[model samples]
Target chain A: MLIEAAHKPHERLGAYLKDEMAAVNALISQRMASKNAPRIPEVTAHLVDAGGKRLRPMLTLAAAKLCGYRGPYHIHLAATVEFIHTATLLHDDVVDESGQRRGRPTANLLWDNKSSVLVGDYLFSRSFQLMVETGNLRVLDILANASATIAEGEVLQLTAAQDLATDEAIYLQVVRGKTAALFSAATEVGGVIAGAGEAQVKALFGYGDALGVSFQIVDDLLDFTGGDAIGKNIGDDFRERKLTLPLIKAIAKADAEERAFWTRTIEKGRQQDGDLDHALALMHQHGALEDTRADAMVWADKAKAALAVLPDDPIRDMLHDIADYVVARIS
Target chain B: MLIEAAHKPHERLGAYLKDEMAAVNALISQRMASKNAPRIPEVTAHLVDAGGKRLRPMLTLAAAKLCGYRGPYHIHLAATVEFIHTATLLHDDVVDESGQRRGRPTANLLWDNKSSVLVGDYLFSRSFQLMVETGNLRVLDILANASATIAEGEVLQLTAAQDLATDEAIYLQVVRGKTAALFSAATEVGGVIAGAGEAQVKALFGYGDALGVSFQIVDDLLDFTGGDAIGKNIGDDFRERKLTLPLIKAIAKADAEERAFWTRTIEKGRQQDGDLDHALALMHQHGALEDTRADAMVWADKAKAALAVLPDDPIRDMLHDIADYVVARIS
Candidate 1:
């Protein structure tokens, strides 16, 4: 394999679509700037500059390119997706009252929650304006529907947290909203904007949806698996009392003694030291980690399979590899 | 005057559009609900049931009726405007950390800020979905731009507060964002969806814009005028350090000692028991309240003037009446 191709799937895709990605970056900067509220650009530039691989925008660019798109509006749509993503992060930080994100202080921490909330609203408006500039009613419809689903999912997650009754179905719904809604919309709109056939759009949507699910599942697994490379401390989820898939599975199969332990720690949120070891042991004994990993593999496979109907280009190949790489880190 | 015409303009318009307003209310209740997140509806219900004038949604119905529209989408657009307004209220409560709105506890106060933020987001998305269903890109464009303006105006308000330098222009911008943008969008979309002529749509926009600014300026004047009838305590704005038109005018004409007093109380926020009374006295001494009330009249007249191009129906007459009633409370 060529050395260039051996880099991570996103990196390779980033290298291949360097110019388009650069255009996306430029559009993000230009759009995030405000003529009136300097606080807007101040808060946004902090998050935008903290850079989370630009994965969502790249998904938009890659999907558009895969369908032979050469339009300028893809850049707008790409930036639009990023703005929505950034807006969500700002609000999420405020909702979580998080102090750090991507190894830096969160916007909510740097400014007050008021700035975070108001700036998030401004970014959402900016994203709406950008997508409207495309003048594609279909694109607008897709994004509008996705936004509802995403927000609904956030609310679901907020209510579902630390609840023992939350099942796998609720978990899937939350994952789709909090993570996958924008991902699927990001890619699906790219194909639609390119005037691709309905089948191609469906395939793009499937690819993005599956990839997003797999990405989130792997992320959840890493919280238990101890993601030192990613700098996420182990048991952070346990300490936060979040009900991830593995914990859900473990809770489902807990014996009376284990049930009491889960109740005190997960439900009651009275976590103690060394409880992390016991939780990990329970997850391992229940095969929750293995099942979650298997679930991730299944989704990654589904993502790769969805690409078969699309045009077979280098971008397509990168997209295919992206599925494997999304699961590869956990392996 | 007819008995109905003698009623408050909003109530008169509400009675006139009773059937359509019922439909709009039904749509709002239906859409604010969440199938998965019970918290969304729970929080939304607390606010939606608060029973404000529903003046914003009424504008949509009246504008559409005046334009001779008979479509089902007017109901949808009316509901959309209300959702956007409600969403703003939710977020505004969070930003203001306000305990009460429209004489009831705010959602952020009843629930937490997290619920306020997320539920507000859900409403915004639901509003987006409702508008997209209209299938009118022009309507979408108008609303999208309005959302951005409203949000940007909010950020401007956040930074402009407690600062003596916030001029009338800045106050107008903030008022437009927080109040006028949605009002104008509500009317403009109503006209556009009704297939009204461009001139009529422009007039509707102008009317909503001027009426909103007038309405807000009058609200500011009432704060210092001791609006006991409205249940708002005198000097609420003074305590909040909000740079309303009267405050801005007073600050603009302050002497050196008066400037020092403003710098101490308003900017430094070291307010005491007599500060509000003193603030009112200064406003009165400087003729700030009179000038502010005069400014409100100017905008209200402008709102009434913009109706010349529209059809001279009862709805049109009510809209004209509304511009007066908005300032009538202070007078």
Candidate 2:
């Protein structure tokens, strides 16, 4: 466990696919350039250079390599995935009205919401252009559907985020839309581009879907347990009135008094200074945090189990380890 | 000319392509719906049902019919174009912080910016899905590039909207990005999907591009001369401090004293009650409005000339007449 902790799954996968990742980065840089609107590039570069792990695109590369196929289009697909992710982040910051991201002032905060919105649209169109260049209709279908699902999920979250009645089912749907849709699409496109068979492609999709669910679950968990290492301040989801998994679980089992407290603080937005601590205490009383952590591990295990059908390869092994690592954060 | 004037080009074209346009409209209505997020359809239905002429989609239908298309995909392409146009308008309203559009309250005003932005994204993704269903990569490329160009043009307009240094060249670029790129794509994709010859396709592209330019020039001109007939208040552009073509021309010829007035009213956005009238007087002093009118005519003529390569079909004739009608609004 210590050795596994020391050598992270993403770092291992990144080292293995270093050259392909580099090409994806180069493409992202080249394509994000605007001949006329310098603000587009300025805003894009601020977020792009904020040092995200590039985890989504690596999933694309790893899936393609594991399929034992070689193609130039994977780089295009990988870059397309990254651009879509970045564009979503830009718009998400605006939607969330976030002031900080990745330990830096968000583009919306630094430049303005207008720049973030327009630049995000530019990046989205840019992603479509890159994907269309591959001339793969299937790839276009997956990514385009994923984009729509992501948007739909976001709209769902907008309406459901503050509603305490937003149950575990709605939470999973939002998680799938906002996070897992892109992950599954990224991996599925790689296999489709590499001409992988139906079984292998399904496995890749299943792996990505489960992994993404685990990743988001862990992210929501970290908003409670994440120290400064996570960059984001703790209790963000709670303060924002986001009814994530833990809160949903807690609310499900709350007594009449506890339900009133949640209704006042969350639904009514009448939060006080110690509301977070009280919320945490309620979560502890219900064992919601531990239960949420257990759920994330179940998802990670599903992700790993899904990969068993794929061929045995170093890249495949890295993907398996990635699933484990995602839940490891919570553990 | 009087009879031709009584029967406007879009109405005639709409009559000619009535069934196709109806199908396109139905498809649009069906696709804008959300299974989970009811807000997506609500906001979209508001703007989609608004009385705008649906001119861009009509261009696609007209182009396809002129190119002798008999396939079912033109309806898909037409709906796709409308979706793209509608999405841009949604985002544009948010960017401009606009309250009204097409004489009605904007989606952003009725709903929130968050709803507008997310719903706009949903429409864009829906448009892409529609276009990809055609399996024509060229159409995808054209529409995707146009989308990128539209976004770039918008960002350029944002930065240049208040700057006095924005010239005629930049204004044209902004106009092309904001208006013509989609027009050209709408028509170009129709021809591409119809398997039109290169010359015919180029002619279609040229016609749409010129028509879009003329359309926007007239829109800008009407802001000053349109009175209440144009639905929007006169001087709205001046109030917004948008440096449209006429104002750009007038500012170019400003004397030292007039330059200060222009700077204070436009560049610095310090407008008093009589400022719009003063700006109009300045434009008159320099013949800016007349010159702008002349420019619109030039573009209309260019649009007519671009149709020379196409067969002399009635749809082609209506397209040529539509170009004239766009400019006729100002004349």
**lDDT values, one for every candidate:** 0.90, 0.91
Error of 2 at A177 (Å): 1.1
Off by over 4 Å in 2: A2-6, B2-6, B228-230
Candidate 1 wrongly placed segments (more than 4 Å): A1-6, A228-231, B1-6, B228-231
For each candidate, the DockQ is 0.87, 0.84
Candidate that scores best on TM-score: 2
Docking class of 1: high
Q: Write the per-residue lDDT of candidate 1 for residues B1-331, one digit (tens) a residue.
A: 2324358878988998999999999999899887889999899888889878899989998998899998899999999999999999999988988778888888887789999999999999999999989989899899989999999999999999998989988998999999999989999999999999999999999999999999888888888886544547778888899999999999999999999999988899999888888888899999999999899999999999999999979888888888888877777
Question: For this target, which candidate reaches the highest lDDT against the unseen true structure?
Answer: 2
Chain B TM, per prediction:
0.97, 0.98
